[model samples]
Target: MKSWPRPEVPTITTADFQLRLFDTADQVIKPVHMPATGPVGMYVCGITPYDATHLGHGATYLAFDLIHRLLLATGRDVTFVQNITDVDDPLFERAERDNVDWRHLGTSQIDLFRSDMENLRVIPPQHYIGVQESIDDVIDVVQQLLDNGAAYIVDDPAHPDIYARRDATPQFGYESNYDEQTMAEFFAERGGDPTRPGKHDPLDALIWKARREGEPWWDSPFGQGRPGWHIECAAIARRFLGSTFAIQGGGSDLIFPHHEYSAAHIEAACNEPRMAGHYVHTGMISLDGVKMSKSLGNLVFVSKLTEQGARPSAIRLAVYASHYRQNRDFSTAVLAQAESRLDTWMQAVRRADDDSAARTLIDTVIKHLAEDLDTPGAIAAVDSWAAGIVGAKDASNASTELTGPGALVAQALDALMGITL
Candidate 1:
């Protein structure tokens, strides 16, 4: 699947800054290493496509978008690959409930997701692959695990299921440092079944699920069934990004079984200890006070906000108001504040006085962003600069051409934060 078009990011001369990120495993912020001049691999777990794009989804994708933008601005060729979980159980259940063909439902939701990403100016992945298109690759990985004694088959009623042995990899529980009880709880809460009786270990993740009476199936040596949740990402990442990549990122919700199982699967199959050099995750978002989830039917969608005449840049600002690692609430007041900020920035850019403060603001924003993607700090820097500029000058310029120091800041904002004013 092709991604949406790249946004019109302005070209700006930016000094190279050391990008730092908080690794979930280490529980500390550290500087990331980049090659001198080569491709940087990143795989962000995409949406399942059973529902619309919500603020939580927007926040998650935009977190990685910042990383992508900074990598590009610092002169690194990025090979970003994000996968759409089109063949997941949520999509199937939603399709069955709505009485729509699953394929048609998945396609429609994916189209809507693409539209949302475009409106938000998200940098699309170079390889936006779907599970349906990578069935062969999934089978190959499963077969590899089975061949390497890392996977086993469970005899079920009509067909046998494939599962990855939890003990096969030594670094199984290193993804999230949660204890067994907490891990099990998150597993059961986030689309995992720990009580299933047929597995060797309760924590053992499914690699392939045998076809049920009304589910989809593909021809594979293990059974006539579809790929499991963990295997899809591992297979796709390996296929597109070789054995190891620079970063494996997703929401903090996926830190448990999803990331752990995905990493373990690759380790078992490829005979490598680690799959990604850095494990980065975004924070959860809330609607008012409640967490935004599909089951609750309380989602603030991106499309809905855009349809209601919200500025796309304002929406970006609203999401960026808080740091990417900090969970925050989205309310009408939040959007209003972001809109006001956007207006001030636009006004500041059109001021008559060409002050040296603009250059300082550019470096300040880059420094804040490099320090663990400190968006709130960067926004605060811009806010202070804008206040100083707008307060000192009464007569504003008539020209909107992006050529002055103000224009330099504007272009850097567009190029770095995906926030175009």
Candidate 2:
């Protein structure tokens, strides 16, 4: 469960900014919190580690990295936690297909993921948990759900299953705000066995899956079965973040059964009203106009890109060109544009010239980022500043420029944007 090394973020003096995010429930960008008494808690879902990290994965983590940076710059103590669903069906299925050991596959993929994050200069989470390490904790949560009458056990002759009850959690459907029909559609699409024989409503999600032959299992009162997809996140978040946290974020794809059910389970077990202050989702990354995914084998691996003469900094810049909420396409053309932008930025910074506009550039990046993590706008502002600096140097005599602009520009990018240039 150890995390990758974190990049050293520069400390800026300005802290007068309001942080806002697009809350999925409210369907609007709003202030996530005011100055509060406790350290801010954030729980972002981590990867299942069945394959290498792709551009879609890169985009999501980098989006959260921006949020993490601004929150620290704004004088908030943040406790961030993320989980690895290493015991999920995907890993088992992939392992079987590849004719390899499941544990070895998970470990190898996790190592690659850590390498990708470290190469990208991302700030690693404080608590990076794996399901195998937290089996006891997950068991306790399932037990509590069953004892509270919030979940029911289904008698499957081969393996018993536990499902969440819609009647126990008053806010079951509020997070997604979908009609029952729509919820069922999404549920069936995203790993939910809606038509499975069970006592509760069709929408009830699986929290415990009884042991099947050759699958991982843990001993509990419920049965010798692994934790379900949704409940693993619920238990992990509760153990580290308590009942409520500031943000629960992942890809937009998880807005359905995954996040909705996780929120319901926690609300029932902890007797709390909600899971977090805000539920945020990042945009998807696509290729040739098709969304990149593991199943489709259409993934653009970050490791492959970096290995094939692509700068990690340029990759970060490419992602910065699009807002986190908008779907973006990945191609060599996009990478070329980003590399060109990075070249201009490095040229400007290398000059180390004195431009009075450095402080203005810093303030602009901070303000734009504070408002919905506006990465594209922030990158644009930087691009303009770099252009002005380069133009002025070319047009003017070799005059003695101020030192403050160069230092501040370099420091601001590293601090506010996690870009070393």
Candidate 3:
């Protein structure tokens, strides 16, 4: 197997912020200085496009958007690639329930998701691929795995299936820190058919799912089947970025089967030591105390919030107010607080004039964000800066200090966090 060209890793440094990354591979939070001589390859697992964009989805993407902005702000070019699992089981199930063509359903929902992301000012990825469109690439990967004895075809009465043999890949769960029981639980929750008979191991995931009676199918060397959920990302990322890349990121929920299996499949295909150099995961978003999920029937859609006259900026702020790695509860109170904080920041930006103070605030924000994307701390610092500016304005120094610091803070917010004031 020939290895693809790898991007040159450069040394990155922020003026006042020391950027640190929490490497899931090593279970350590350490300073990251990998600057990009070329574009930094970033692959984020995207939505399945089966349902509306919810708060959980918002938080995950916003978390990565923050990282994307921070990288750009610190002078690193990024080639971001996010894959849409348009051919997944949930999408087909939803389409069947809605009595609509699966393709049409996916297309409409993806449009809605794109609208929501755009409204929130989230940067679009350089390559946004769909599984159906990348069938060739996926098929090629599966063939490689088969040839290398990393994958095998399982005969099923209904359909022929190809599974990635977990036993063949020693690094199957390298990215996941969960124990066997916990991993099994999450694996089942996230579409892993763990107990399915004939797999080399219960954890072995499907690479190519044989054609069913009604589901979409593609012509492949294996048979008339569709690519599995995990294989699509590995294929697409490899196609766009190469065998090894800078980072692979998604919601923490994907750390188990999705990310873990994807990494295994990629490594198996390329015969490489690593797929992604770093794995970054964002925390889950819970509603009240329970995790907000479509399965739980407790979803706060982005469309609903926008329809209720809530600003997209406020929604983004609500998600950004908490650390990306910490699970946050969604509530009306949280949204209200975010709106209020955004208002305060906007007012301060309008009145800020102290360049020295503005520089100081920028440095403080950078420091907070650079430390493993500590958004809450960074936001707190900004709130404090805004409060002080407001106090100074009330004390009659408003005319001179307001504009400078205000503008600087606004720019910093936009640059560091994608929060436009």
Candidate 4:
């Protein structure tokens, strides 16, 4: 007998890869390849610890958690890290408004974030790094940029700022896809206050910022201060995952100044071409046909959603029922639909006891999922399979299908949607 050859492992490719709006239209993320090899190094831009985690945050993180699980299931040893922006400007404002110590507020909100994650069944990151714990890393990156002439310190007594040297890198707007010339023209055309502290160029962003009275701080190379909003993520991501990682995911709002500035800082500090191989951003969650945002006063607190009798599974299903990149309108009706769909799958699984029908449904759904994590397509596939089983001509085959792959289909669908049996 001839010796058998070894089976080649399947390689993940960017073709038909499911990606969302990062910073630009053309910026896309592919699977980890040679230079960027890893157990799928991933960094999700985490919450600012000021308020309770909301439905939007739930949608975003659950999406990431699904991707993380899928990557793991695909045989990648994943190291997922998420940073808590525990000491940003908003924390101070909220602290002052609430008349609580900044440290206390940070601790409280971090607790809340953790609690919310547990409630939603979103897995915690392998590393839950917070801005306060990683100040030294933040300072080190800032110092690197300064040494490399990609950063400069401003001395305004009121609110000093460490600005990235936008002129040093021609690729400042590379991630954002904003034309530098156009940006300059736009800024020049609309001049604001000329003497505002640390407002040198409209495009320049802070790497380090002086602490305000009653704000958090640490002794840094720059001064007694805190890291800028963007720098915190860069430092934390670099410290946890190497300079180059598989993917960076966050809300679509972070695309511009936040993720863009982080990219510049990483390039300056690490002297690397890419901070992350691909940047994945999720769309906003809306309420009642409008965007659910705190500014809009239409935000649905995760706590409140639970109070209103929304199961975490149902919420997850509703948001993910549509593509992650598509704007998801959050309403009770949508949740009802998700609940209904989940019930159908559960019932089908309960009835399924054989392999053939169940296997057919599972195979079809898996194929659709492989197509760029096309979950909507996959869900439709499940619906079709269930419908077929219900309409099967042979009663014996239908029963067999239910016993076999039909049950497996429910497990698979639940695995994808974080829905429980």
Candidate 5:
């Protein structure tokens, strides 16, 4: 793949508010420093566009969108790249069930996904590449891996495919933080055929799969086949962000074989020790104590919520009210609470005064968000500020003091949380 022109990283003038991120590889919270000369590169795993936009999907994307907003607020240029797995097995299966062409299904869902994101005020990535469009690049990376002896052809009579040698890369499970047993369990849950007879190791991941009957196939050096799920991300990231980027983000569920193998493939292809500066994974969303899944039929679709007249800002607030790395339960009660809090903030903003109280509240919120995106803390700070504003208004003639503070609060909400009031 050809190298992309890196954007110049601007000098950040915001207060020395250190941004802390939980690096999955190191398993610790570390301060995130912006690069001096180029844009902060972020690659987030996007949707497959087969299912409805559920709360799980909403939470993941909003988490990254928060990061994107903060980076820009700190006066840094960010080149965000999110990939769409348009040609994956799930999409194909869903298309077959719906009796529609897979490509057409993908296109329709992509449009719907775009609409949902826009409605929620989630900023779009600068580059949104699809797997089907990047076949040549994916194939290039696969061939490179093969030539470097990092990957091998596995020709089982039952399952002919290209597999990445897990042992070949010492850092294969660096980000997963899972033991062998736990890895095996989650790997199976996340689409790993662990018991397949011909794989060199139980953890060996498929890099390329030979075309099967009725499946879409692309001509490549490895013959008529498509890139494996993990390899598609490696290829797309390499094309946009080069060998090493600032951050690689996805849901915690992908921490296992998906992200683990993605890092392995990119490092093997580039001959670099690190694929990304940081690996950040968001927490999962569950309903009634069970993780929401399409198979389980327990999904809370964002489209349905909006269609039923739920405000987009309320949904966003509901997700942002919790820490990004903590599991959240999806329920109407939570959304109602978020809506109430959003309303309180909006009211406070309307009656804001340009006083020390409002400025102090804004500073506190910024500080909380800077420290590992403590959104709950930020919301609390805003809540306290709103309470004080309301109290002051009721006690005395303080309407004159609110105009400046109100405008600042509104600006902060929009700039920091994408909440326009």
Candidate 6:
């Protein structure tokens, strides 16, 4: 019998519509279609840049990086934009806690994050707009929201933050599937004090907040203060990715207030359908079955992982070993397994002599990747081909076909999983 043909490229299949794991149950992500010959646009919510980049951060960025790479491999043009939230409430608190200037802290941590991205071989996005640099744009967004009556500045004696009142916008809780009544009840149960001086509603978060003691300051129509944590992304995404883009992705923790608020901000600002076509959120990385936390003393730094002799490629492989949407456990053992698998795939790639068969195998993988990024399934296909060759009852056919499929597998795996040997 003739030997089975290897895949044409490294990708997932479009025919496969596997359930995309999403934290937002009612959230529906529509595929982006571009007039030109490529993907429409992609925007990912970025970090606040305080602590050293950790395993959880790596998982989130790498998952999207892989998605970007796979989209390009499938012959789609992609404009990937990830923002840098350099000014916000969190940055203020962190800077105060450490007795550092807010700008200095933001700059320091942003650089560290860039280094982490470089170390992990995560592709640099075309746009990395920082909140401080984009203050004018954020101000513009705030002004628009105010004009639309979607935002109102009120004084709070207790909290004193300039709030975007929930009562102002009918679409306030639309993204999170919470009606007005539900939102009021939700925040009330959680100790929301709407009557505390200036707040119109208990659920209102800050759009542009007044400068607090020991925090950052930027001049705006509202006051001499900085943008709020959630407003930065909302404004930055509008400036770079426009009202609606291809996909918006980040950690699942951002789903509620961060992402949900961004959705409202965009709608109130632009009167658009949705901020992004699809919403993709990755699950957190856990250490010892607990979510990664510096407070819990279980945070694992990606840089530290390398210092302890973990290979960069292996670290990436360990990250992608499971579905991008699944919660991944960080362990040295799993990383070792990743390294071992790479070695096997590379060995097979090196043995192949036929370029035609290699190309065919690569194309097969590409098809696999396009199917909602079915990486695990794609890896399974490669492994099955390798296993067939090794366990084949026939010798001559095995020897001929094995080399090509094996070589192609390594190349394609690198394209999708960043596994290079």
Number of the top candidate by lDDT?
A: 1
How does model 2 score by TM-score? 0.96
Where model 1 places Cα greater than 4 Å from the true spot, the runs are: 395-398
State which candidate, 2 or 3, has the greater lDDT: 2
After best superposition, candidate 6 residue 233: deviation in angstroms?
0.7
Give candidate 4 misplaced runs (Cα > 4 Å).
1-37, 157-159, 180-200, 390-403
Question: What Cα-based lDDT does every candidate model obtain?
Answer: 0.88, 0.87, 0.82, 0.70, 0.83, 0.68
Question: Which candidate, 1 or 5, would have the higher TM-score against the true structure?
Answer: 1
Each prediction's TM-score against the native? Answer: 0.97, 0.96, 0.92, 0.85, 0.93, 0.83
**Hey, what RMSD does candidate 1 come out at?**
1.3
Per-residue lDDT of 1-421 in model 4, one digit per residue for the tens?
Answer: 1111211222322122332223342455243442345577888998887776888888889778777756654555788888887777677788888998987998877777777777677766788888878989999999999898888877676677787766556667776576767555543333212234665566676778777776667897667888877788889888888788777888877776677777778887888776776777888989999988666888877877777787777777787788877788888888899788776665566565557666666666555555445678877877776555555534443342333455466566555455665
In model 6, which runs have C-alpha deviations exceeding 4 angstroms?
Answer: 1-30, 35-39, 156-161, 167-174, 178-196, 353-364, 387-407
Task: Report the poorest 10 consecutive residues by lDDT, candidate 6.
Answer: 1-10
True lDDT of residue 225, candidate 6? 76
Candidate 4 vs 5: which has more TM-score:
5
**lDDT of candidate 6 vs native?**
0.68
Where does candidate 3 have its weakest 10-residue lDDT segment?
1-10
> Which pairs, if any, clash in model 1?
none
Itemize residue pairs with steric clashes in candidate 5. 352-402, 352-406, 353-401, 353-402, 353-405, 354-405
Q: Give per-residue CA lDDT, model 6, range 1-421, as digits (tens).
A: 1111221334532222222324253455334444354455778888777875888988898888777776655456677777877766567778889988877887777777777777677766777777767889888988898888888777554334566655554545555676667655655443244455666666776787677775667787666777776778888888877888767789877766677777778877888756665677887898867788867979888888888887777787788778777887877678888787665555555455556655665666655555555667766666655554444433443343334445456656666656654
RMSD (Å) of each candidate, 1 decimal: 1.3, 2.0, 4.8, 7.4, 3.8, 7.1
Kindly list the per-residue Cα lDDT of model 3 for residues 1-421, writing each as its tens digit. Answer: 1111222222323484556789898798886546447888889998888875988888988888878887777776888898888888889889889899988998888888888887777878878888878999999999999999999887676767999987676766778877889888988888989888777788888999998887789998878989999999999999999988878999888898889889888998898777877899989999888898777899999989998988887898898887888989999999999899888887788777777878877888888888899888888888888898776676344343334557667767776777767
